[model samples]
Every structure is written in C-alpha cells, then in structure tokens.
Target: MNGTNKGGAAPGRGGGLASPRFAAVMASQALSLLGMEILQFVLPLHLLNLTGSGALYGGVIAAGFVPYTLLAPIGGVIADRTRKRGVMIAVDAVLAIAMAAYLFAAGTSAVIAATVAVLMLAFAAQALYQPCVQSAIPHLVESHEVERAVALVNQVGMLTGIGGPVAGGIAFGFLGLAPIVFISAACFAASALVVAALVHVPYEPPARTAGAVATARADLKEALAFLRSRPLMWRTIMAATLVNLFGSSFFNVCSPYIVTETLGLPNQLMGVLQGALAVGGLAGGAIVAAVPGTLGIRRVPALLLGVVAGIAAIACVLMVPLPALGTYTALVILYLPTMAVCMCMSIVATSYLQVESPGTLVGKVMALAIMLANCVTPAGQLAYGVALDIVPAWAIALVAASVTAAVAWWLARAER
Candidate 1:
C-alpha cells in the first residue's frame, strides 16, 4: 500500500491496518460481486418460471439499470456531501434487508416487487458507494500503487464473476432461489462489517460551502460544467457510452437466449461461458499489473487493438458453423479474451479519470459518466430486443461488434 501520489509528493504513508483494510475491502467487494452474480442467475430463472416470457426476463435485468440512470446524480451528490463510510455501511444494510425481503417472498409477483425494490435501493447505494470507493483509494495507499489497487479491484470483480454464477447454478439446482438470496444478503452484511472495521480512511471535513438544497443544485451544475470544459473527459464518456450501448446491451439482452435457444446449450454450459469471461478478465488484470507504467498513457493503443481483435474473435464465432457444444466452447474462448481486453481498457480509462481529475469534483464527474453510460445500456438492450425479431442473432451481433470496434477505434484516435 506504500505508493506515490498524483501530485508527486511522497507523503508519509501510514502503515497501521493498511493490509487489513485492503483485505477487508477486497473481501467485501468479492462477496458483493458473488451475491450480484447469484442474483443475476436466479432472477432470470425466476422471471422465466413466473412469466414464461423472454421479455419479462429482459425487463428484470433492465429494471436494475433504471436507478443507475435516474438516481445516480443524487447518489453522487450525497456521497460528496456525506461520510463515505457511513453511506457505504448504510447502503449495505439496506441491500441486505432488501435481499432478505426477496428471500421471504417466493412467487413471481413477490419476486418482481422485491427485485424492483432491491434494485432501486441498491442502485442508489451503488451510485454513492462506487464514487466513494474510487475517491477513497488515494487516501488509503501511496499514489504509485493506485494502478495495482485498481487492478485488484477489477480482479475482485472478476473473481466474483467467475465464481458467483457457477455457485448460483449449483445452488439453484439443489437449494433453489432462497439460497441465492441468502448468499447475496450475506455478502452485503459482510461488506457492511468490513466498512465498519476500516480505520485508516483520511477524513475530509464536511463541505460547509453549500446548504442541502442549493448546494445540491450547484454541485450538479458545477460538475456538469467541469465535464464540459474537459474535451478528453467528454470523449472518454462518449466512447464508454457507445460501447455499452451496442456491445454491452447486445450481450446482456441476447446472450442468455442465444445460449438457451439458439446455441441449444444447457444452463451449466452458460455458467461456463460466464466463468470464462471472468477468467479472461483476471488475465487482463494480470497483464495490466505486470506492465509497469501508466496504463492510461502506455497501453491505450495496445488496449484498443486488443478490443478490436477481441471483437473480431467474437464476430468470428458467428461465422463458424458449429454444433451446440462447439459453439458454446467457441463462445467461452472468444468471451474470455474479449471481456479481458475490454475490461482492461475500461480499468485503465477509469483509473485515469480518477487519478487525473480534481479530487473534490471526482464524485460528480464519475456520477455523470456512469449515468450517461448506463442510460444507453437499456436503450441498447431495447434496440437489440426489437432487432432480434427481424434480424438474425448473428447479424445483430455482427452489427454490434462492428459498431463497437469502429467506436473504439475512433475513441483511441480521439483520445490520442
């Protein structure tokens, strides 16, 4: 955790509990990710069983993003204004309670209601928590370690991505949805505990500049104005937004059905696909870590190249005529490298933003970026959902891949 600062000032890095704090944060994040993955698996299965409609399954996933779009700004403001640890702890508690509610209620209507409620609350928490965590990293470690810290964060996410679904699938087969809920609840609760245990967070005095009502509006305005002034930030946001809109949307909306229907793959095979993506993500993180430099500066072109190459690999899967097993295996292979490269680039971009931006305004800028990027995800999902009716799945995927590649290329050039 002993590292450098963005300012190039080698401040006396505190040692007490830094290791423990890092461990606590990683464990909590891993648990939270596991919980989310379990829910991702179970929620769809629940929706499918309850409504027997693919659209409903899509809707369930879409519902989670709603708050990311609507409440993210508010969440950002609150995180900036409030104590991050307290906010994080409170949100974790709320999420735990929400999951508990879902566990108690078993039917479709109840599940939907619970899902909506949890998502609304969880989204609000995430909006606040994410910025807080991002902002807090600098406070916890030396500046030089920021990249590693960011990579570790991505790694934790990947670990959850790899493990959560597989465990959820197993749990689903034997113990059912309740187990998933219980696991999610446990993760949140554990995260809350970890937050409570954190002792080294450098305290920033409360912002005394603005009142609650006026301050919020001004903060939002200032944040937006700040972003407008930075062309690079705007371009980065645009690139991320477009990628999410096309690539992320298509994958989320189409992948499950593609596996279950088009590819005729079993649920277990789908789990493997998910796991493979995580594995790719882990590998990407390792690559990022091993390379010693500002990934934001050093690897931009290479990252974009990987993205283009990975997208082509994925697109190639569509052209290959293979049986279900072969297709699933091909997808797993394609998925790992694609996701790894994509995530590495994303991590670099995010770390760059966090490190380079003014600390005071970091929450607002990130919130806006998240809001804009997330807003497009649902639109992408909706567009693909409609397109699937008329267009072949492979055709839709090809378009998405092509669009994403072109956008990524444009972004790379624009960023440079």
Candidate 2:
C-alpha cells in the first residue's frame, strides 16, 4: 500500500516533492494546465474580437466568478466529506466534457451568452477542484515539504503558462479554435485519469451525533471560527481580495483592449504578453522552492506595495503611443515583476495556510477564506467594466493601484 509502489508518495521526513504520488499529480496537472491556459487566452480574445466592446469583455469575465464564489464553501465541504481523489477526478472529467462548449462558441450566434456559459462551467469545476488539490498537498508530503510542494505545483502551472499561451496564440491563429478545444478536452480527460490512479489521502468525516444539516452547519462554523482566531487569515484574505479587485482589469480588459484594440495588434501577439507573466511565475516558483521562508508572512504587505507600484507603471505605459510590437514588449516587461512578486506571495501564503490548519478542516477553511475574499471581486470586476466605458484604461489601472496600496497598508496595520 506504499505510495511508491502504487504511485503514492512516502510520508514523514523522507517525503518531499520527489515522491511518486506528487510526481504523478504534477504530471497530470501539467496536462490539464496546458489545455486550460490555451482556452483562457482564447476565450477572452474570442469575446473581445467578437464584440469589440471592452465593457462587454469585462462583464463576461465578471459573470463567470459568481458561480465559483458561491460554490466554494459547498465544494470545500464536499472535498472534506468525500474522498479527495473522487472529487478531483469527477470535476476534471466534468470539465473535460464542458470543453465542448467552446466548439459551439466558434460560430457567431449568441457569442456573449456562449462565452459566459463556458466561463461559468469552467469556473464551477475549478471551484470544486481547487480546494481538493490544495487540501491534498498536506497529505502528499511530509510536514516540512509543504512549501516546496506548493511551489512545485505552482511551478507546474507556470510551466504550462509559459508554453500554453504562446502555443494557444499560434494554435488559435493558424489552426483556429476547433483543434484547441479538442486538445483542452483531451488534457482534462488525461488529468482525471491521472488523479484516478493516485493513492487515496486519509480523510474521515468528523464524528457528530447531530443530524446531517446540523453536522454541516457545525463543520462550517468551526472553519469560520478558526478563521476568526487567526489575524493572518483575515489579512491574507483582504490582501488577496484587493489584488483581485484592482488587478482583474489588467487581464480581463486592459491587456486585451490595449493590445488588440488600442495598439491595433494581432491577436497572436497576446501570447507574448501573457507568456511574460508565466515566465515570472516560473522564476518565482524556483526561488520560493529554494528559499521558502525568505519572505515572512508579516511582510506580505510590502510585497503588495511592489505589486501596486508595478500596476501604476503599467498604467503609465498603457497610455504611451508606441508601435504594436513595442507596446506588447513594454507591457510584458512591466508584468514580469508584478507576476513574480504575486507568485511568490501566493506560495508563501499557501504554505502558511498549510502549516496552520489541521488536515481535517483545511479544505473548508481555505475554501471559506477564498469564498469570502471573492465576494468583492465580482463587484470590482463589474465596476471595472463600467469604468472601462467611462474612463481611459490608464486612469482605471492607476486608481485601482492606489486604492490597492492603501488597502494593503491597512491590512498590515490591522494585523500589527
């Protein structure tokens, strides 16, 4: 029953990122991520070109978040109550089936509706799937390898990000959307199969003498109570929410709008710009893996400050009238530090979460934190949509950055 023989990982001090189970998970993750990154790039670009409206683009992106946010707590409970592998396997399989929506999106009829539906479907699966994966981290390795495991998983994502966007752009441009959609489906199916083969992590429903509803309520209440006791939890959640609030526009509307509409660049050029963010992620993951605790949890505010400054700089360049390729290169350059810091901060926080929570409640706790934080995101994204119509993208980015800096400072002070 050892993880090594069954593609499971070893436990205790010997366990690290090198374990077979983690290795298998990473391989499966890579396959799904490759397809996902492609669709992520394609979906927005398809919407932008189809509608030619920045507001509509942002609105579509914003709509997809509602379901994911709503499903987070429910998903977390499901992850805790059921076998983690089953939750992951089922969700990935469902997502694979959902990828078919893209083929329908190729045609022009009801493109906005189709876009929103597909986005919702993908997010819904992610809402259920993400916590299971995060929760699985502790079970996969020894206590010590938590940070390294998080970084390695993140590194897998960035690896795909590096290739997925570029491949997506080229694939979408030359081959169009059909083949890309099929590839995405196959990748998700592969991910499900890989997870299906993973050794089961230990999980048992908490003993409760009460009824099912009472048990669910008590379980949720405990996760909330635990969250309330930890100042770091709230601080981290606020900081992340602020990032999503102020930063969503950069990807949701600003980058695409500036690259395709403002700068008059080809859709394929977006690959180069997005690939820059992934490049930063790749580097960040390496550093985080090597020196996991280099940046303390308390200093996350300082990191957030750097992100705000980066966004401000990005806003400035967005207004400059540069040639298409030059502009793409400039945005890519600006995004590097921002993405790098964000990726590192993400690793640090995720590690902190793992260290602090017990395996029994980690899934629910993390999911609730994420869910609460995301509540504000839809509003921010939607407001950004309205702002896109009223103001230049520069002003929106600049203002969002400033507000984010203020929020980050507040979190630091509050935590102190």
Identify the candidate with maximal lDDT. 2
On residues 218-321, what C-alpha lDDT tens digit does candidate 1 reach at each position? 98898888778978777778777888888777767777767766675556666667778789989889877787354654355467666666666766786688
Q: Which digits, one per residue and each the tens of the lDDT, describe model 2 over residues 179-254?
A: 8788888889988888888645666565679876777788889888987897777678877887777775556557
Please tell me which predicted candidate would have the highest TM-score against the true structure.
2
lDDT of each: 0.71, 0.78
Where does the lowest 10-residue lDDT sum fall in candidate 1? 1-10
| Count of clashing pairs, candidate 1 | 4
Candidate 2 scores a C-alpha RMSD against the true structure in Å of 4.1
Any residue pairs clashing in model 1, and if so which? 3-142, 3-143, 4-143, 4-144
